[model samples]
Target: MARTPFDAGAEFDRQVRVLTDLGYPELSGLGPERFGALVAPLRARAMAAQESRYEPGAGAGDEGRVPFLLVVSRNVAPIEETMPRTVLHGGRLPGFVDRTFEPGSLERFVATEETLLPDPDAYLLFDIERGEEFCGVVPRDAMKAIAGRDRTLLTIEEGIALVTHFPQVLVKNKCFSLGGSRCGDRRVPAIWISQKAPKLGWCWEGNPHTWLGMASAGTRTGGVA
Candidate 1:
């Protein structure tokens, strides 16, 4: 039998159950507010890091050294109110917003430093896979400028394209679940993304048996057959 295509919503539910089992009570009822709360701290951290790295002495070199916060939420319905306040609070950061599933609108949100932020050193990617499907296209002119540059921390897919043609650089994949909710016995699959690697990984929680049985059993491949 052939493998099934990944269902973003179903995977989101699976992650919700994992959080519930881990005693995250709020995750059992995850809503927009809950998702916001989960991501706020991360946004703050990324912003603070960007501020720290910025210096007048660095000049144009500062452009390529900023870190980014990528957010991925699949099931939550898109609402203007659901837009992150943090982005607007201290001024918006150059990032993408995914409204791909919505009708009649552009699927992705692309912001350059001038349009979205005073400085485009860092990014806060909202809803990774959804953003990709919705608005992953970079304009041809922009692609021409940073074709083989190392300073840019492009999103996973973009990074893959750059790296495949130019294999001398490093790519990183930073994976984490944003938030989720459980329905029936199914847990929803949450969104995931990496800064460097092309692939994104998502799960409600780490598998219990894999950790407990394998580590405790003191074997490379643990558990009894």
Candidate 2:
């Protein structure tokens, strides 16, 4: 049987409605500026993570560079519920896996990352290295007990929407050198967001601490940028 065609815009709108129910007014209009505001912090954190991963005296540059954003989204359905039909490069693929997580050790490596299972059913991992991102959908009934209860700073819908929208802008802007060899290509800075706590928490775990130390060093030497 032929599969029904999926509409990206329509799907986005449906998710926007869900966001409305969750009290995200900004996403309704979802203008470039509004989208940028939501994405700025994530981008900053990704950059910081990259810097931290490479710290001072950690070689001149580009020793082990993995620059890319890992973006995850959660939903109240199976992983396929929100999986995008479009490819990372905006083309069709033979299968969903091809468009989502790259096949190989990279996928296995990503699965090993400390995963937090919060209420609601969705999570995403953005890979700055491969210049690709992956999405995971949690079972809808998985969070029935905590559905209305506010367990975290941001609701499930809000978190997913934020992660989802940000990458679109990043890709559109051509912020990172996605696919190539040199350090630039390998150097993909990434930010991983998931609902692990009561409030939105950001960390620079994957990258080295020296990069963050440098930022602090700069502040002491001068002032924040």
Best by TM-score: 2
Off by over 4 Å in 1: 1-29, 47-51, 56-138, 151-225
Q: Which portions of model 2 miss their true places by more than 4 Å?
A: 1-29, 55-66, 75-82, 88-114, 117-225
RMSD list, candidates in order: 21.0, 18.9
TM-score of each: 0.23, 0.26
Alpha carbon lDDT at 9, candidate 2: 30
State residue 128's C-alpha deviation in candidate 2, in Å.
7.5
Residues 141-167 of candidate 1 have per-residue lDDT tens digits of 222332333122233222221122222
Q: Compute the lDDT of residue 170 as modeled in candidate 2.
A: 24
